[model samples]
Target chain A: MLDTILSFFKKKESSKDVAKERLKLVLIHDRSNVSPQFLEMVKGEIIKVIQNYMEIDEESLDIQLTKTNSEDGERMVPALVANIPIKGMKNAGR
Target chain B: MGEVIVITSGKGGVGKTTTTANLGTGLAVQGKKVVLIDTDIGLRNLDVVMGLENRIVYDLVDVIEGTCRLKQALIKDKRYEGLHLLPAPQTRDKNAVTPEQMLKLCDELKEEFDYILIDCPAGIEQGFKNAIAGADKAFVITTPEVSAVRDADRIIGLLEAHEIRKPRLIVNRVRADMVKRGDMMSIEDIIDILAIDLIGVVPDDENIIISTNRGEPAVIDGKSMAGQAYRNITNRLMGQDVPIMDLNVSEGLLSKMKKLLGFKTA
Candidate 1:
């Protein structure tokens, strides 16, 4: 079932879709009043700090940044959200 | 109720004043009382393009400074009875007028005209602030070029930041032939990028230069296809559900002309 659904959307995105995605990213950055370089620097610092005290596999970790509709356009308030895959926390508990 | 609309583009030479003049003329031609105010102090051109420079006994500065009455400064167009102009002070700096003063002046003008069109200066500074201080809406003008669109995007961002919504777009200098040849951006591409409602699309015509020289807008002449587009926009603004001019009409003309020229519409 998943294979059928995945194949259905495996088709390439239209040129219009590509252009809209680019515009959305640029507008998000512009509206948030934050530079892409600044976002990168922030993501790097937050990931580095999160890895220090976590019992998770760094290689299988993913950290993504996004904008949420807030009171202001975008306050640039960083959210330390991550999905870290724990390799063997149960085995370590023993 | 009088609606104040500002024609603004953050970048220079994107034809803000020209769009303001033409739209004002279009609205006036439709029998709506329209007054175009040039807010590009010390470098005014609405007066020049509208051909009312010599008739400007007073300007925005004069009204703000209490030197003259607002009606005294307004030069009514003899050609179009409903059209009026409030020229910018060519000799005074932009600092001569404050945003508050502009707001009050617009409030005064609102009582008189159906539409008060403000021609904003380029750049996002005090001049821009003054231009938008009292505007009920914004008509952003941009050419179908990367630089112009980018500046327009920036201007739209500023508007969003300032909580200015419902800002419509006017894509000027659009050459359909160039767009077909992939040399110019299409209307669809622009609207997709800007994410704004397309209000008007003015084609690049040599008659614009001639009309500017004559102080007559191209929209007055039915021969100019671009003029028809402006007239359509004016009708749309006046609470009328008029269809788009170029997209439907010009395409038919193009296919017909192409067939005549031994070219097929594929």
Candidate 2:
């Protein structure tokens, strides 16, 4: 109910905004030369590794290939960043 | 030395050839000796666009292949004393001429012409490589659409990799009415994403199609809005600071309705 009220107050995104957002995401993948399927595979592996020790919120996990400026600000380097949320640790009750 | 400028757009049907034809004519009108090279092999249209298709006895491939001299293949435009065209061979594919050959050709033409404008073929392939091979500068042409802009970004990345730094952009076929309504991407929006220096923004005009069909580039028509835009771009290219065209169509439906209802608007 609160989210709906806040969203109603927010300005509607134009088609240009949607295009820019989509292009930004697609370009990140293109510049890194990483396929979406490959990213999904990597995400699956990461989730499997974490599942061995902890209970993770799979729905909240986010992984993406992005860019960062080099130390001297001369070059843009592609970086793979991931965020995985944890709900609880396995065997905590034991 | 002459400046070899490649008009390239990664996606097809964006107006690279039209820009090439207009810029060639525009620069020549400014008393600059200009030569337009059609590098889009297997799909040659520059000659047709320039209305010099019937005069092609020899082509770029023939010059490179040593069958004909460079001068023999260059078709002189009837209107301009300085403007010339080295058309692509419609029969041959892109593999017919190599990048090294294109570089040598540009070197030879540099001595005679003030500007050598190469019309690049679509896609990042061998044809594209050959087009940019001899170019000192590149003008990326793209529309306001998402796909064209995305392709332009990719082309820009490739240009950077080839060490062709400081590429300028030409935003082509922009609809003023659509932009006013936020239905189309504005020049500012495109420039913000592309992160390149803007040379000019050409407004979408119906007259361009008419002029193109007649094989006379719109830049020659003083009455054309698109022609004025091209002329401004030409002046800008010659190192003059020309103002961008005001693309706001003032007498739109809203204004008409307001006028009918007697509501004065600013």
Candidate 3:
């Protein structure tokens, strides 16, 4: 019910919003030179490797490329961070 | 010594050459010796824009290749005596002149001229590289659009990598009506994302088109809004403090109501 009310008040996306969103997505790929297919392949391999060790929640997996400052805060660096939920260990409860 | 400033934009048709012609003319009109260099090579248009296409006996490649002396190659502007143009060769491509050659040419010109403005070609290629080789400063121009601003950001990053610590920004062809209607991005929105110091903002004026067609820079026209903006930018370039021109549309009751409803108005 609250979601519907919030959605009703939400402003419509204008042409400027669409353009800004498109630029945001394209610039990330352009700067990193990474493709969606490559990211999918990497995700599949990572999930396969993790599943061999323990049960995992694949649906909850998230991966993203973001910009972060270097150690000395001198330059911007592209970082790939991931989060995956673990269901259970393969062998024992421990 | 003169300062070599490169007018560059990664995207095409964003008014790099137009800005170069105006700023060069503006400086010359201010009693400064200025030379405009068209580094676009095969796709040269500055000659036509400056209305000196008929007087081109020698081009940039000729001066660099020793085919003609620099003085013989420069085409003098009829309107402004202090303004000259070194046009690009229409036959050869970007590879005809190297970065080293450009640096040497700029070094020789610096001894005589007060300003050396290089009009860079679009895209981050060899032409762009050679254009900036001799520039002590860079002015990155962009329209207040998503694609143009994105390209401008990329160019800024590339300029930083090339050790150009400070690059100014010029937002051109801005629309006041659209901004008042909450349809177009405002200057503040653009500056927030680009994170560069704003040098100038030119309103969308139709006189610019007429002046371009006439091969006369609009900066000399006192009635043109864009011309006024260029004059302010030129003053800023000369270390003078000139306030940016106001581009705000008249605030009617409807606009005031729209603003009260959380609508963003430029």
Q: DockQ for all models, in order?
A: 0.10, 0.35, 0.28
Evaluating just chain A, the predictions reach TM-scores of 0.33, 0.55, 0.58
How far does residue B48 in candidate 3 sit from its true spot (Å)?
A: 1.2
lDDT of 1 by residue, B1-266 (tens): 79999999889997888788888999987789999989998898998898887898998999999899888998999999799998888888889989899889889889978999999999999899999998989989988776688789999878876777978888888887666654566677777678787677788888888888898888888888777878877877776655454443347544443233221110
Best model number under DockQ? 2
Q: lDDT scores for all predictions? A: 0.78, 0.86, 0.85
lDDT of 3 by residue, A3-83 (tens): 567545545656555566556655665655524566777789999898888899999998777777767564465677889
Against the hidden true structure, what lDDT does model 2 obtain? 0.86
Which regions of candidate 2 fall more than 4 Å away from where they truly are?
A6-11, A34-94, B249-266
Please state the error at residue B64 of candidate 1 in Å.
Answer: 0.4
Provide the lowest-lDDT 10-residue window in model 2 chain B: B257-266
On the 0 to 100 scale, the lDDT of residue B195 in model 3 is 74
- In order, the B-chain TM-scores come to 0.91, 0.93, 0.93
Question: Residue A46 error for model 2, in Å?
Answer: 16
Predicted candidate 2 versus true structure: per-residue lDDT over B1-266, tens digit per residue:
89899999999999999999999999999999999999999999999999999999999999999999888999999898899999999999889989999999999899889999999999999999999998899999999998999899899989988889988899999998787777787777777788887888898889989998999999989999999999988988898766666776454533432233221210
